[model samples]
Target: MKKSSMKNRLRPLLLTAVSLTVAVAVSACGPADEGAVSAKPTAAGVEPSTGRPTTPQTSPSSSASSRTTASRSPTSARTTSTSTPTPKQAIVKNTAAPRTRAAWPRVTFARLTFEIPPGWTLTTYGSDACVQPVHRAGLPTMFDCAGIAIKSGSIAGNELRSYEARQPGGWYAATDVQPCPVRPTLADGSFNGITSGTSSPPVESGLRPVGSRKAAYDRWTAACTSGYRFSPQAWHLPVSRVLFLDYTGHAETARVLESVRFPG
Candidate 1:
C-alpha cells in the first residue's frame, strides 16, 4: 500500500514536469510566430494590428516627383518677380531764351540785302525768291506757283516776286484790288478763273520803312475752296519795283523786314 502511495506522488511530479515542458515550448514558439507575422506583407499602406495607415515607402517615381517640385519652385518665384511692373518717368518741357541779332546771317536777293536767322536759306526761281529754313525743300521753278503768296499754303517762310503781267494786282500797288490768287485745283498748276473769290479788304495799308526807302505796306486775307485761308502781306517799293511778300506766320518776319537794306 505504501509503494502504491509513493507511485501516486511521483506520478503527480511527472505530470507537473510535463506541464512545464509544454509551457516552455509554447513560450519559445510565441516569439517566432510573432516575428513571422511581422515579416509577412500586409495590405498596401495599412498596419496589421492597428488597422491604421502607415508611412508609405518611397519609390523611384515618388522621389523623382519630389525632386521635380523642388526644381520648379525657383522658376515660379522668378516668374512672379518679373511680372511686377515699374513706374513711368515724368516729361520735361523746353524753356530757353531767344537768339540775338549779331548771331543772324545775311542774304542778298535781287538788288536788296536782308538779314535772316542763322541756318536760313534763300532760293530764287527766276524773278521769284523764297527764304526759309535750310532743311526745307527747294521752291518750284515757276513764276507763279500755288500757295506762293499765302502763309497757310506755303512753308513757314517769305516769298518775293517781281511785277509781271499775269501777277495779281496787289503785288505792285496797294490800291489794286484782286481775287484770292491760290488756285482751286492742285492737279493743274495753271491759274484758273478766280474760283477762290475776291480778297478781303486790306487789314492794314500805309507807308512802312524798308531800309533807305519807304515802301507801301498792305496786309489782306484770302480764302480758297481747297480749305486754305491765308494772310498775304506785301512791302512794295514803287521806284525799285522791289516787292517783298511774306505769307508765313513766322516769328522772325518782323526782324527780317527790319533788316532789309537798299543801295543808293
Candidate 2:
C-alpha cells in the first residue's frame, strides 16, 4: 500500500513540470513571423519582397548611374572653359597741331608778273594807273609800328604844299609825276629843307604785307624841286618786282602770290 501512495505523488509532480515547460516554449516562439515581416518592409522603403530579403545587390544600378554622371562633369567643364575669347581693345590717340609755312617766293623785278590772291580788293589810284589794295588791315605800319589805321580805302598824307594832301584811295598815287632829285630811299630821311637836294643812297623800299610771298619791303621818300609846284616829284620804290606805289597821299602794296605759275 505505501508503494502505491509514493507512485501517485511522483506522477502529480511530473505533470506540473510538463505544464511549466510548455508555457515557456509558447512564450519564446510567440510573434517571431510578425517581427520578420515588419523589419523587411522598413529596409526596402516600399513593400517587402516575396523573394530573398537578405540580398545586398538591390541599389547597385543607381550607384552606377551616379558614377557615370560624375565622370561626365569634368569634360563638360573643360568644353566651357575653351570656348570664350578676349578681344583686343583699340587705343585712343591725340590730334596734331596745324603747321606753318617757313619760306616764300623771292624774284627779281624785271621778271615779275601781276598775280593777285583770292580775297584781295581792287582800288583806284589818283589820275594815273597806280591802284591801291589793303590786305591784313590790322598789321602794324612799316614806319609807325604803332597800330596803323585799317583803311581798305583812302586817307591824307603829310602835307608839303598849299595843294590838298588828301590821297584819293587808302594807298598808291595814280598821278603822272615829275621826277624830283630825291633818291629811291624816299625823303632821304632828311627833313631840313626838301627843296633842291641830290638823290638819297639806294635802300630797300615798299610797304609789304606782313606775311606776303614777295618777301621784302620797298622804301622811298618824296619832295618838290621848285617849291612852286602843287605836288611833290621825288618818290621812293622799295621793291620793283613787288611794289608799294604811293601817289596823291595814297600807297598801294602789289605782290604776286601763287602756288605754281601756270605757263601762259
lDDT of 1 at 97: 72
* Candidate 1 global CA lDDT score: 0.58
Indicate the TM-score of model 2: 0.22
Tell me, by lDDT, which candidate is best. Answer: 1
Residue-level error in angstroms, candidate 2, position 150: 22
The TM-score values for the models, in the order shown, are 0.42, 0.22
Q: Taking the tens digit of each residue's C-alpha lDDT, what string does model 2 give over 1-264? A: 999999998998999999999999999988768767655534245544576654443466876797788999998898888766667798877667768754433322223333333443333333212222345354322222111112211222222211111222212222333343233134555332234212332233343343324333323343454342212222222233222333223222223323213223
- The alpha-carbon deviation from the true structure for residue 199 of candidate 1, after best TM-score superposition, in angstroms, is 5.0
Give the alpha carbon lDDT tens digit for every residue of 64-129 in model 1. Answer: 898899999999999999888766797776667767647578877667778877777676765567
List where candidate 2 sits over 4 angstroms from the true fold: 1-58, 80-134, 142-264
Question: Largest TM-score belongs to which candidate?
Answer: 1
